[model samples]
Structures are given as C-alpha cells and as structure tokens.
Target: MINFINKFKGKSSMILRKSKPYRYLICILVFMTTYALLAMGLLPEKYSLEVAQVSPATIYAPRTVVDPYLTKLAEDEAVAAVPEVYNLEASITVAALSGLNQTYASLEEAAIEEDPQEQELLLQAIKENLSEEIEISHVRKFINLTSEQREYIYTNTYEILERNLSQGIKIESIDRAKNQVINELTLLTTDRDIRDLLIDINVPLVRANLLYSAEATERDRRQALNEVTEVKILKDTKIIDQGEVVTELHIRQLEALGLQETSSQDFGYYLGLALLIGIVFIIIGVYLNIYNQSILVDSHKLLLLGIIFCLTLLLSKAFSYFSAYLIPITLAPLLITILFDRNIALLLTIPLAIFSGIIVGNEFTYIILALTSGTVAVFSVRKVNQRSDLTRAGVIIAAANGLTLIALSLLTGSFQGATDFIKNISLDIIMGMVAALLSSILTIGILPFLESAFGVTTSIRLLELANPNNGALKRLLIETPGTYHHSIIVGNLAEAAAEEVGADPILARVGAYYHDIGKVSEPYYFIENQLGNENIHDSMKPLESSKIITNHAKEGVSIASKFGLPPVIIDLIQQHHGTTKIAYFYHKAKEQGEGEINESDFRYPGPKPQTKEAAIIMLADSVEAAVRSLKQPTKDKINDIISTIIEDKIQDGQLDQCDLTLADIKKIKEKFAKVLLGIFHQRIQYPQK
Candidate 1:
C-alpha cells in the first residue's frame, strides 16, 4: 500500500509538471489572492451624474414708424404756412399804422395848400381806414393763442402806437416807425401761443420720463425671473399651531425627507467589478506566458521568472501604500531581462504591467502609466551588461516617463495647477528611476537561484567564468598546460568560424574553452596533455586506446552537468565529438588484422551536432589537430586538410543531423581554409648554421 501510494504521488507530480492547466490555475490563484489583498481599497467605485437646466427662449422685435417721405411732406407744409400766418398779421398792422399816419399828414396839407377837396378826401381816407378783423384759426395751434388773448394783445399794440403819436412824433417818423409798431403788435398777440407752446414741450418730457421708467422696470423684472418648484412627500409628523413657533422636531422631519439611503447591492457590484478586473489580469498573464518567446525557455526558468515577476508586483503594491515612491512595478520585466534573457523580459513585461495595473487599482490612468513604464523599462535595458548599465537605463526610463507625463498633462490642460502637475510629473520620474534601480537589485539577488535551478549562463556570468584565475579554468591551465593552450587556440578558431556562420560566438568560445575538459582526468593519455613524455596510447591496445579517447566526450558531459553548465553548453560538449570514429586507433587496428572488433566501441557516443556552433567547433577541432600533424605546413597542405575534414564529415553523415546545408558547408570550408592559411603563412627562413 505504501509503494502504491508512492507511485501514485510520482504520477501526480509528473502530471502536474507537464500540465499547462495546473500552471495556469496556479497563476490565477496568485493573481486573485494578490488582487484581493493588495487592491482591496485601491479600486475606487465610480459614480456619474448628468445634469441639465431648463431656461426660457428669448425673442427680439423692432419698433415701427411712419413713412419717412410722408412725414417730410407734412413738416414742409407746416413751415410754408408759418410764413403766411406771419404775413397776415403784418398786413393788418401795416394798414392800421398807415391810416394813423395819413390822418396827421392830411391835416398839415389842408393848412398849407388852400385846396378844400384834396383835404376832405385825405381826411375821409384816414377816418375810413379801420383795422381789418383777421381769421386766426389757421395759425392758432402754432401761435398757441386764444381769441381773448389775441384781442388783448391787439389793444396793447394800438395803445403803444397812440402813445408814440401823443409824444409829438413827426409824420415822417411815424412812417419809418411803422415796422417797430408792427413788431410790438405781433408780440402782444403771440404771448398766449408762447405759453401754450411751453405746455406742449413739458408734456413730451414727462411722457419720456415715464417710458424710461417702464423700460427699466421691465428689465429688472426679467432679470429677477426664476423657476422654483417644490416637491412634497406624504408622511406623519407633529406640526406646531399657527400662533406658536415650530419645534426642532418639525425641522428635523423636513431634513429627513432630503436624506437618501444607498442600496447594499452597490457594494456587491463593486466586489464583482474587482473580480472581473482580477480575472482579466490573470488572462493577460497566461497569454503573455504562451506567446512571449523571451521568457518561454524551459518550464523551470519560466516558473522562476513568473514567481519573481508576480512577487515584485505584490511588493510594489505593498510599498506603494507606505509611499508611492517605493519599488517600481516595471522593474520586474527589467529584472528578468537582466538575470535571464531579453525575450523572457519582454514576455513577462505584459503580465507585470497587468499586475501593476491591478495593484494600483485598475484605473485607466494607472494601467496606462504602468504599461508605459514597463514598456520603457524593457526597451531601455535590452542590451544591459553590468550593474551600472542599469543605472543608465534607469535614467532613460525616467526621462521617457517624464516626457509621457508632461505630454499627457498638456493634452489634458491640467498643467496650469503648478503644484499638482509638478508633483505628478516628479512621481512618474521617481517611479521610473526607482524601478530601474530596484530591477537591478532584485536581479542580482535572484540571479544565483535562477542560474542554479535553470542553468542559464548569462554574459556576465560567462565573463566571470572566463577569467584564467577561476578555479576550474586555473586547474586546467596549471595541471594540463598543453591541453589548456590547445583549448584557447580552438576557442579562437571556433569563435571566428561561428561568427562567420552567424551562430552564437560567445557560446562557441566558451564551449571550446571547456570542450576537452575531460582530458584533464587522464592528462597524459591525450597527446596535447602528454608534454614531452612518451605516448601512453602506444602501450595500450587499439580498442583500449579508442575507448580512453572516446570516454572524454561522456566525461565532459558529466563534468559539465556537475559544474552546472547550461543544457545548451552541455549539448555542445557532448555533440562536439559526434559519432566520428577515432581514425588513428581504428585504422591501426584494421592494419594489424584485428578480427571482430566492434566499430561502435571506437566511435564517440551517438548524438551528432544539432547546432551550427557545435558543428563548427567539431570541424575546427579536427582541422587544428590535423594541421598540427603535418611535417612541413603549407597553405596548400592546410587547405587540403580543412577540405578533407569537411568532406569526410559530410560523406560520413556526421553533418546530416546539424542544420548546416551544402551551401553552408562550402562557406564553412572557405572560412576554415582562409583562417588556416593565415595561421600557417610562411615566415622568413632563419639563417642556416
């Protein structure tokens, strides 16, 4: 029963390891738990109110007036009548004055001439010249006079003229004074017209004042117009009597009518909203995992990176509560890139952005901010190599964030408020910079665990390992100096060849440095590690010698695993030897008539080179070793050796498994020939002894 239980547990573990659904469930659980805790109060419930006001439409009208041409004709006619009215008054005055003058003149003529008939006629004309009675109705309105007023003016005018005559004025003086007399008569008669004119002028002035007051009152009333409506509710309440003051309870009851109670369902709705947001974030995380190639290495690395990314998101939220200036959420992707690969960093950036949004409360502003920062972080540090590189990248991220914030502020017209604008802008820069720094810090902290568990050899780690003083490399140098020197040359050759074919030159170089590391186990058995000593292989049988040499490939893989080399480098170490036979030992055995010898025993273990770098390293290794065996090296000999090695590998089907095509092989052969020629170029012949 115990064994069965153990088997069941193993199967479950295997299933869990292979199951995508299980991982997805774990991711969802993590997201939900984090959202529930970190975003509890982060999300704010949004409420909207729409308001509209009712207003009266205004209308405008123009005042009407009589036709201009008709009014002009009426004014002209009235002006023409004024002259006639004045002429009539003048004619009457002239006639009355002429008669008075004639009476006086005739009396003087009768005393002087002794002509009785002339004298009598003159006297009769004077006596008969009575003042003509004029009809005044046509000029009455203009003159503003009543009939009694006109008569009184006429009497005064006559008396003034009689007074002038009584003062003994001469007849010539009377004729010249006729105009003065007429003017006096006209003034007396028109006094009532002037008084009535004053009344007419005063009436319009009074009416104008009243109209102005009415217009002003109408303007004020229009300004004061307002719509007021009252709503009443049915309720039972105590009321005060009409003569008594209202009690506080009455006022409280009125106030209670204005209060509203919110429904409990609102909170439930908000909770569901939060859940939906959390689910969206989880879905984003899963999609990012599937499609993002950078982070999609083996399952182990993905898991480690996912955990770190999620943790960073949660920690950023927790720290944000204390102060929003703490750990930047975008640093998660940057950190992944720093410790792992850029592809992974870019892939994880999406989920990390989603997590950042959730932590900051799922607002559109926060989501956009997080996404912008994360994208900037990933792009800015794509080529980061050192700790200080992250600092530079951090500054870049800060600048990008600042620019984005300033642009947004400008677009939203919120830049007028200096304090809030500067504060928000500063926060964006600080968060971006802090994210970069924190990413570097967290990357350094988590790198060892990830490297150990996933066997990732970052460039920084490789540089550290390349130092001659490193324990493993130093041991190889001191104990097997010849092998060490050979490995360095092979590394140089492999790096050049790998670069020519557009393969990973760093991996090729590093693999070359460690490719023959197992030769250190039996240092003297290999030719390069034998120093000046005798050949160990000469004393051993062909098959035994072949076995010893073939064993190094297996031993190198074991050592690589023990030392935690990545699977890619380990594959290179193993497949660098491929299934090629140990030709020297195997051919010697054939010539010696060795019967029934297993060919497989003489070959390196089976998996051929699967990548260009591994295949290049294998070819470089063979060409370098074969060129060293030539007695007198020449360009022709070096070229022949390189071509033979390539052709032999091709004919033996060792290159079949690798992706190198016939065209690629030809290119590789040319590159090898050129490099070999340069290495074996002729030097100046020394002077003979």
Candidate 2:
C-alpha cells in the first residue's frame, strides 16, 4: 500500500510538472481583459429632417392697365376741366352713322322693285355712297347672310357701340350702331362673333379705345386702390404623434444603447476571435517550428503572423468602408496559405475569416468571400517554392474573392446600385496581390526568429545550415573531421530519401549533419575520427562504451543550444536516438551476468521523433552507417542492408512516436533502398582476374 501511494504521488508530480493549465488560463485571462478594454462604443448618432404631405401654393398676376397715370389725372376735377381734343370728330361720326342707316333703308326699298338691273344699280349706288364715309370694304353683301353670322355681326357692332358711348363720342346711337355693323362686314367670312370681330378690327385699335374709355379707366383705378391680403399664424409649434417609431436617428440610438449596454461585448467578441485566430496562428507557428526543425525563439514569425492578420483586417475594413458590397472573407487565410504553408494557412484561415466578418460588421458577404478566397489560396499554393508562386496564389484568391462579390451582388439584386463594383473587384485583386507581397516580406523577416525560437526546421534554414562553413558544420569539421565527413554522406543520403518521399529534404539533411554533434565532446572515442588508431572500445567496458556513444545525443543538445539552434532542431537532436537501448552494451552486460543492469542507463533520454524530417534523418543515419560497413560493394547487398536498417528501426519502435505512419515508413524504406543501390551499384563485376 505504501509503495502504491508512493507510485501514485510520483506520477501525480510528473503530471503536474508537465501540465500547462496555468499558462493557458493566464493567456485566456489576459486576452479577455484586453478585449474588454478595447471594445467601447465609438460611433455617433445620425440626424435627419421630417416632412408631411401638403398642397402646393397657387400664384396670381393682375392684368396690365395701359394708362393708369393719364386715367388718374383725368379723374381729378382740375384735369377734367381742360379742353378735350377732336370735339368735331364726334359730330362727323354721328352724321356718317345717320346717312349709312338711310342708305341701308333705301337699298331695302330698291331691292323690292320689279326691275333687277335697277335694284343692282341702286345697291351699287348705296355701296359707293357708304365707301367714302366708311370704306366700301366695310359694306356687307345682302345676298348670303347666315343667322349665326348675323348674330356675330350684331354682337361685334354692340361692343363697338358701347366703346363709342364710353368714350363720349358725339354720335347718334342708331347711326353709330349701323356704322359698327358696317365696320364688321369684312369679318362676315367667319360665323363666330369673337373671331369675326377680331378678323374685322385690329387688336391695337380696340386696345387703344378701351384704354381711353372713361368707364374702363374708372374700374382700373378702383382695383388698384384695393388693400393687399395678409397671413397670420394661429398657434405655437409642438410635437404631435411620433408615427411608426422608425428613423435613422432611432436606429442610431438603438445601436448606441446596445453599445452602452454591452460595452465589453465587441471587445470580448473580437478578442475571443483574435485569441482563436491567434491560437491557429500559434499552431501554424508551432508546426512551422517543427517543420523547419528550428532551435531558437522566433518573435519575428509571431509578429509576422500578427501583421498578416492585422493587414487582412485593415484591408477588409477599407474594402467594406469604400464599397459596402465587396466581400472580405478570404483575404487573410488565402494570403497566409499562398505566402506561407498550405496546412498552416488553412488551419488559421477559418478563424481569420470569422474575425474579419466581425470586424466588418458581421456581414455574410464578407464571410462568403473570406471562405472562398482562403480555400483557393490553400489549394492553389499547396506546395509553393518561390515568391512568385505566392503571387499566383494571391491572384487566385483575389479572383475568387471578386467572383464571390459579383455573385453575391447579383444574388441580392444590389448590382444595380454598384456602378463601379467591377472596378472595386479590380482593386480587391490588387489588394490581394499587395497582401501577398506584404506576406512575403513578413515571412522573410520573421522566419529566422521563428525558426530559432520555436526550433522549427524549414528548408531554407536547413539549406543555410547545410553549407560547409556554417558555424556548427565548421566546428564539427575542425573538432572531428571523420564525424563531419560521415555526417555529410548521411546528409546526402537522407536528403535523397526525404526528397523521394516528399518529406522536407533540407530539414532531413541538416538534421543528419547535426545528429552526431555530441561526438565533438569526445572525438577520439568515436571510430569515424580515429584514422586507423587503436580502438578505444577494446579498453573500455561495453557498458562504458555504450554510455559514451549514447552521451553524444545529450552532448549534441548542449552544443545545439550553445550555438543558438532553434528548439525544433534541438528537439530533433534530442529525439533522434529516442529511448532505444545501446544494443552492444546491453548484450555485454547480459553476458557478464550483471544483475538487473538498469536498461534506462544504456538508453537515450528522448521524446522521440515528432516530425517526418526528424524520423527520416534518424533512419538515414543508421542506414548510412550500416551501408558503409558492407564488405562486398554490390547493389543487392547495399539495398538489403538499407532495407534491414529501416525494418529494424521500425521493429524496435523508433518511429512510433513520430507522425510518420506505416505507409510513410514503407515509402521511406523504398526511397532509401533505391538511393543506396544507386550509390553502390556494382562496378562491372571484375572478371575474377
């Protein structure tokens, strides 16, 4: 029972030592607090004018008076006393009116006479007699006068009679009326009174006579003297009914109230989104760390990820502000994928898009666009090798985003109002390209730090490390030439195998080169650097020898750290040996009957290979060593040895902790076999000479 308690306590202690709950909780708390602080209401209310239906006002203009001053002057008693012009003209008009009437009566009597030629002669005589007094053209024909034309002529003659009377012309009423009728003879062409009168007399003459008429002048003066009307308000302004309860102001107020009520909501929401997004970023960061097999802390990588996320949000916000119809969904995710790694980009893109939607007012259009663009970015740049590849991926993302915007615009019937939606899409494409460029710049700037800090093992970094003059490589050369040479051959073999199976060749090669760095601590003890010197293993016990060999893994880690290798490379250095027993020493201990020798002492301290590249290097290191031990150089032998080494590692469970599956190992084995065969293909089997 005591032993059981002790065991339980020990296990609990170990669990507590490894647990990261406190760190995670702290991260969450800080994020929540930060979000709460930044999400306060920051917008203002909107205002507008209100109006109801009303009738339009009508306008009026008074008729024009030709001679107001003269009429007014004439109205004065002093002015009326002055002598009036043309006093005899009225008398002549009266005699003419009488004579015209007398002629008309004579013509009527002559018309009834039996003789036709005498009647025609008498009518001609009367027309000639009226011609000099009142133009012969004004005389009417007696042959064809319709009733309507006669009535019209009568109305026109009466108007002329009234005008002459009002003007105080001294003429007999009967003669004046007869003369007026005669004056209208030319208008007998039309049957209507108004048209006939207008046809007979000129308008200017009629207007002049009306202007001079005493009655008309009196009426105009009276109208001008009337008072103007005035308007007055009856009541003070007041609010009536607040109909419908809907307006821009009301909506703005509601938004304001919402913001006030949930002051921390936006912050919390966005922060949560940011955290989720950040975690995805970190995961990608972590994976990249692993992928690159980095050995140092990389703040720049984290900063780059943050910048990419921020720029994505900024661009999305700008797009939304500039064109409410544009979708901002895929920009960040697609950009990350195209500019970085597909898997990492995909893992983070979802949250990035969600956060983007929130930043842009949780718009569905933005969500759709983000998702589409992110997917396209990931798929298009799945295996990017160059910066241009990122550009191409960005183009694809932009096109996808544009298509989404257009399609949504069309779907929602918002296309009509978007006069320059196509142009906006072009801008979005440009933005996407810009995003890619920015991402590349960010990646280049951040990769080194991330690789160093996170212990990530990227191809670029591995290539850099693989150079012979690199500090670590150079140190290895000066300290242990044989080990260095061995590492180079192992790196070549591992690189070929990794490349064949689509694993990270640079990472594998670099890892292989650095795998035996621990040998630098005790260069003379290792056979690779002995240069045909006496074997040290002969003098030391098998257990001591195994201890020395296994110590290299530990010593390698220390050296990696001293050189500022990234955590990923350090992990590879540590995990490459796993906890596998040093076989020779374990066998020697058994042969010597050392009672229960601790197998743990002969094994390497390890968490095992966690990535494909690391696992490949481990397999390559063993295969290269075993292949060099081949007695007869033959393709078959080399191939067999390589296959056995891979099979043995698998059987011994060295690859179990890594992500590499059985299928992956088989592929790896095939690659190793092929490479080994190529390297040791039999030179023309020398004819047994």
Top TM-score model = 1
Instruction: Please estimate how well model 2 matches the true structure, expressed as its whole-model Cα lDDT.
Output: 0.59
How many Å off is the CA of 199 in candidate 1? 56
Model 2 alpha-carbon drift over 4 Å, by segment: 1-351, 361-366, 384-392, 395-432, 446-460, 495-506, 533-544, 580-615, 643-666, 684-689
Task: List, residue by residue over 63-117, the lDDT tens digit for candidate 1.
Answer: 1212233434445554444321111123334554565445334434443444657
- After superposing candidate 1 on the true structure, give the runs of residues whose Cα lies further than 4 Å from its correct spot: 1-39, 42-298, 323-325, 338-344, 384-387, 417-424, 686-689
Give the per-residue lDDT of model 2 (tens digit) for 1-689: 97588579657754543445643443455445323322321221222323342212211111111222333433553334433332324544454445434543564555455686876676567556432334332333432245455455445544554455446433334445445545654454543433433333322122111113455545555544442122211122111223443434323222322222323334555556566646754665476667642211333344445555655555556565555334344445544553356666776677667656655555566667666667776787666544455566556655665566667767876534555656445565555445544444544555465555434455556567777888887999999998998888878877887777777776778888898888999999988888776988888877788889988999998898778665567777888878777887788888888677888878877767788878888887888778877877677777677778777777888888777877777787777777777776667766775
**lDDT on C-alpha atoms for all candidate structures:** 0.62, 0.59
Model 1 clash pairs are 143-193, 144-193, 294-343, 294-344, 295-343, 295-344
